[model samples]
Target: MAVAGVLVLARSVRMTTKFTSALDIPVEFVTKNVKLRGKLHHITEKGLEVEHIPISIPLITSIQRKWQSKGLLLVKLAGVEWAPSGMAWLQQELKPKQMIWFQLLGREELALECLVLVNKGRFLSVCLNEEILRQGLGRTVPIKGLPHDSHLHWKLHRRLLRAELKALKKHKGIWQEESYYERLRDRISSNRVVQVNSP
Candidate 1:
């Protein structure tokens, strides 16, 4: 009984432990697919900058400068390459200081590849990766940590592909036809005719 109590206490401590930076996170946590909560700070060309929210443990947190600012985590959405317009869309969709959850998919240098989720309502949470594809604002890419032939990889790939298909079928965003002026410009640039034949 004493051993079980100690084990439970250790697990709780592990769960509540706060990381100072991306490097402070344990490899096992990432591999086990741990989810962390943070506030949306801003979007950059490289990725989303999120301010990690440390778990508050009443008395213990009070001793640890409870009001001190937490460090930012640089996270990239796994399985999607954002388009230029997609960045704009993200800026508009996510408000500053909004609560969000990011599941660690993999780590690359100082940045983390994550599946970013935002609550749309009380019960619905939306995945930004698949949504970007569904909007035709991005293309699906391989998830970094998941093995290519693994079941998890295939499942995620299928979801992303389906989202992309929806956009293709609807002719949305990048899937839409080019304007006449743009098409004409491309044709003129490509056609190098020295002289035109007389009609």
Candidate 2:
């Protein structure tokens, strides 16, 4: 019985070490679809910069403090591409140091494609990806790192399309009509055109 107990303890230690080692590599975490919690650092043209808050594991973390993970992760919203107003909208919606949950879906190079959720109320959470489409601030795009015909890929695609449809119906943001300048320019150009007589 003593030998069995020692074996079990040894296995647990090995597993814990493996998990901690993976934390040190951000790409490993991204490829594994590891959910992370972090504070909003800033917005970038490519995507959001998030300061990752490493998960603390009791005594193990304290001992591995020198090797513990610490850095910003570039996160892009999965299944959506920004429109002209998308960046500005995101800037206004998310504030500095605001706590958010990053549900990683995939990774492309150094950027993690994720579904970013923020607290709406005491018990409510809002998905920023869908909201961006719903407001017409962004358009649906093929989700990277997912198979073209995969079930999960289709599920996310349908949801994003629905959000974009809502914006279209309401004529919001990009869906709205052209500006006055655009209309006036077209009118002036058309009036300047001359008709030629045929021989």
Best by lDDT: 1
Error of 1 at 11 (Å): 2.3
Backbone clash count, each prediction separately = 0, 0
Model 1, range 65-133, lDDT digits (tens) per residue? 654546788889998898898999999999989999999988888889898999999999999988988
The whole-model lDDT of each prediction reads 0.83, 0.77
- The stretch of ten residues in a row with the least summed lDDT in candidate 1 is 190-199
Per-residue lDDT for 1-199 in model 2, tens only?
9999999865444434422222343555556666777788889889888876655567655665656455677888999898859999998998889989888777777777888899989999989999999998888999997778888789988999999999988888887753445678888777666333323
lDDT for residue 31 in candidate 1, whole number 0-100: 85
RMSD for all candidates, in order, please. Answer: 3.7, 5.1
Each model's TM-score, in the order given? 0.83, 0.75
